[model samples]
Target: MRGFRPGLVPTLVVAVLVPLMVCLGFWQLSRGEYKRVLMQQYAERRVAPPMDSTELAQTTDPAFRVVELQGHFDVEHSILLDNRQHDGQVGVELLQPFLDRATGAWLLVNRGWLPWPDRRTPPVFSTPEQPVSVQAWVYVAPGATFQLHADPVAAPWPRLVTAIEPDKLWAELGRSGFSYELRQQGGPGAYRTDWPVVSMGPEKHLGYAVQWFAMAAALFGLFLYLGWHNAGRPHGKHHESNQHV
Candidate 1:
């Protein structure tokens, strides 16, 4: 304390910045933990035996639960979710209404991604006319629903949109259906079904946490060094006297 004196401005800056950096570090850690738990749940539910529509309707938490679907796709009212990228190629995901014959329940199914290189023409995709058996998993978005741009209210059949709202789609179509979207697994009615559970993994969050914490430590260290260095400097009067002598 004798030879270390931090200026008021520096102390104030450190007071604000250090705590902010530390809080950010902890926030990143929490995010990493959350992603880890989410991925674990996804992995567990994905491998379990596929459930029927009746069984699926009863389940409360069905994030990645696989379901066996005996349904035929409605090709007329197709939804193209825009701004989807695969292997550095721009594309859109095709979603169609499927009527499950067994349970008489309709559900929105994401068939998969298709390359839409030219905007002048619609994305090319096909639908199965006959009732087919397919396996798919319930896809629940992790956080709040995001949409880059709102879908037009009166968009025609084969609607092109930035987001998917199955409930709204069902309401518009005047069909009683499952609210959640079912992502089709590889089969007759699937295209590029490879989906990443999380965009940024836990490791990325952990790395960001380390960076924030390291920056905080470096700032505090610099604060200490500056305090000591400033305190050790000679006063103006002492320096003037010494120069004159």
Candidate 2:
């Protein structure tokens, strides 16, 4: 027992704890990095080469980003999705069908924002009956379902739709040829173009990661303290326990 020191316990615990904490920290960093890469991909896709919406329009996967759409607007089928906010303002997006006379294809154009007021219905839009050409980035709306039921059915046109999938929409309306689907182009010309670009929420995710790591570190510390060092115990519990054994 001569020259035995009491510091060894804390040192050993910290050695194990630090490595675990370090791994957790690195894991969160990696997640942040992955998010950054994805964001970069999104940005690059936006600026890469513009595509023809009618030609690229397919019944398969919903194409996302950088599509060129040119055709006449089918004003009759225009729909407004509720609850969209941009830059501290609330608004509704204008969605209309573009028909390519040559290919017989259709593209859904999300024209820009129209300021919305509190009302039972979306603001009415006067649409052009003649042929119109439109270009926009593409995106797919997420599918949403409740417990054992689909969400509510959408209103008939010039009506508001909630969580409508483009493909399902095309089928329901008997849509045909057109290229690219553009989202967030909500503004004038055809619709309001005032909506902000889509944010993948990298900052929010990184913040969440930090919170998780913090909780892990805190819980580890609390467990170590309670099980080994607290509860009216003396300062030399490790030494006493080790020596007594």
Candidate 3:
């Protein structure tokens, strides 16, 4: 008859790791659901008529809402967001301040991704001298980034940065209400703006959850295979054989 016995070391490792793996699977499942809701919101709002900056001001959650603004691009004070990747090629994202002509408010606008000719030389871009109208989606800064040191926003015009720190930029520009960023629609001073609707879609998260669960299952199986022989006690014929020996 089979029994349920396992070695001390294997038992200890399994006890510690199995639960951790299962917990990771559950976490990924939750993350997947969150991503699903966010993607749904994006899809629904994609077709809605664009709201102007004044209308966008009243929005409680302004992320992903299509919006428009009449502004002049601050070409001299633009920033190049470094370490951006597109289509397996390394590049940077252009971020420039847009001075709203109607409200006289300045907000950051992400022009789009641009490929680097090389690391040393900065990419060249031309901005329109006259005031222009822009249509874009409202973007709330989503998360934080890891940085060894705080990026100096006051270093120079056309700043190169690892991440956007709106507060620092606002302070540098001496502008107040540096709240939301605009993800520009294809227009003048815009590049390839095909940003991902969802950074990690539900399918990707679900796949990760499956992988975590699979690892847990494999660990349990290993514990069983390694410990199986140690399970059953000696019985009947085996007992007799032991006595004879």
Candidate 4:
């Protein structure tokens, strides 16, 4: 207060911005921690032995859990998830209903991504008519599902959708099915089955947090410097007047 006089405008700007930047920095740290925990859970569940369809149906926390499936794909009502990209090429992920023979429960299985070079023609794919065994993992989205456009109410077979809702699909097909989607690991009916656990890693979040914090520090430093600089101007003028007298 003695030799520091911050202008009202600068004080107001710092008051509004500094707290906001600090809050954003902490929020990013929280997000980074959350992503770390999620990745750990995924690693643990993925390594465990694959369970059967009955066990899978009874599972409460089924994120990233492996499951063994013995079923035939219902190719007639396939769903092509739009806007999927792989290796810098535009593509769609193929999802189909598979009936588990052991438990008589239907499941929506994501086979894999397929490139659609020409929009005029549908992506080519085939289904195994006979019973086939495969291994897949339960895929629970980290956040709310996204859709560029809502699926039409009366969408026909081989539907093109931006999001996949297993419950809605099962209801439309009039079948009692598992509510979660199962992403195929590798088997007879899989194509490009490799999937990443998370889109953005924890390190990226940490980096963003650092940037926010740095910006807050820089702004606060500028505020302090301006306060001191303005205060010194009046003190220097008073010293000169006293010397003249």
Clashing pairs in 3: none
> Best by TM-score, which number?
1
RMSD score of candidate 3 (Å): 3.0
* lDDT of each residue in 103-202, candidate 3, tens digit only: 7778888999999869788787778898888888876543567688878736787788997877677886688754767789998778989988656789
User: How many residue pairs clash (N, CA or C atoms closer than 3 angstroms) in each of the candidate models, in the order given?
Assistant: 0, 28, 0, 0
**Which residue segments of model 1 deviate by more than 4 Å?**
none
Error of 2 at 175 (Å): 3.3
Residue pair clashes in candidate 4: none
Per-residue lDDT of model 4, residues 63-116, tens digit only: 999999997999899999888888899989999999999999999999999999
RMSD (CA, Å), each prediction? 1.7, 6.8, 3.0, 2.4
The positional error of residue 155 in candidate 2, measured at the CA in angstroms, is: 2.9
Could you tell me the lDDT of residue 13 within candidate 4?
96
lDDT of 2 by residue, 1-245 (tens): 22323256665766677667667766667766776665566678777776654446443644445655445777777878666777767777777776665566776677766778767665867776666554566664322322344436555667676444567678777665343346634323555664433343557657766776786678567656655544345557776898888
Which stretch of 10 consecutive residues in model 4 shows the poorest summed lDDT?
Answer: 145-154
lDDT scores for all predictions? 0.91, 0.61, 0.83, 0.90
Ranking by TM-score: 1, 4, 3, 2
Candidate with the larger lDDT of 1 and 4: 1
Q: What's model 2's TM-score? A: 0.68
By summed lDDT, the worst window of 10 consecutive residues in model 1 runs over 142-151
What are the TM-scores, per candidate, against the unseen true structure? Answer: 0.93, 0.68, 0.89, 0.91
Give the higher-TM-score candidate: 2 or 3. Answer: 3
